[model samples]
Target: MPFGGEPPQLLKQRLLYQGRRFSFESSRLRLPNEQEGEWECIRHPGGALAVPVTPEGKLILLRQYRFTVQGRLLEFPAGTVEPSEGPEETIKREIEEETGYRAHRWRKLGEYFMAPGYSDEIIYAYLAEDLELLENPPGQDIDEDIETTLMTVEEVDRAIHSGDLADAKSISAFMLARPFLK
Candidate 1:
């Protein structure tokens, strides 16, 4: 069967909560067994992330505080996809804002649903190279307290193994770009 059997049908949807970046929606679904139930879904506009590599074979990463986790995390430069903005535009802007580097080259690595079970958040991953430091980078957001860091591929591997790089999105983005890294 195309959908493995009779597909569940959406009967109704109601917004439970709304936030700046996401929303919670409750959906009523009719199942294959003719049972009806409700499921909560986290709706998001998704985002883009860049695994930036310098000509010197170093990777540009971010160290930022995540309030949700109540701790700092090491992550790649990333940003939410604003309405009417493409993924590439979001990543380019984010890399420059977060790392003060502009990439002359970019390659679409892949995309993944970060948390499929609860959230409809998909992230477009990109590999960025040919970087040049921006002489006058745009001012970073006041709410952001980001510290940019450069690391060799080996250093990144060590961080991954040591669990120092625990941001799931960044780890996944790095893995996607690993094959092309020097």
Candidate 2:
């Protein structure tokens, strides 16, 4: 009955964390063969990323230290989508918050799972054009230390090929955007 039985089905779910921003839960389920199991899953608010294009046709990138990766990474402007907010609204807010730039037009590039194996977090990628710099710098989180870098599309391409840019989201977004380049 190892592989022949049907998969598990959720029977009951209990809220674990119900904060002002997010909520967490634990699910109890019954397998096809009558076995019971429990799984913990978070109902994330989702997120968005912005591949911002400068007025000079350059891409705006950010270099920051990712604790989970134990190293610094070069990535596009991105942030978590607030509860009850649309993807476009999230991207616009994230771009402004991370890079201090306001995008006039936004094109949705694609959506992907951050880590499909473990979490159900979905991230929507976007291409932002017609940008304007904010008079004030972005107000980063207290623990966040990010440096913004403006690079030409060619520079980003070279970095990807040279192993300088290693973040998955950045690489994927850049690849998706390659077709639009001249």
Q: Ten-residue segment with the worst summed lDDT in candidate 1?
A: 1-10
**Model 1 per-residue lDDT at 76:** 92
What value of lDDT does candidate 2 attain over all alpha carbons?
A: 0.83
Model 1 regions lying over 4 Å from their true place: 1-7
For residues 53-161, what per-residue lDDT tens digits would candidate 2 score against the true structure? 9888989999988898888899998877876788888888778878888999878888887765545778888889999999995677777788899999889988888
- Model 2, residue 141: distance off in Å is 2.8
Candidate 2 structure, TM-score to reference: 0.79
Give the root-mean-square deviation of each candidate in angstroms. Answer: 2.1, 4.8
Candidate 1: give the clashing pairs.
none
Clashing pairs in 2: none
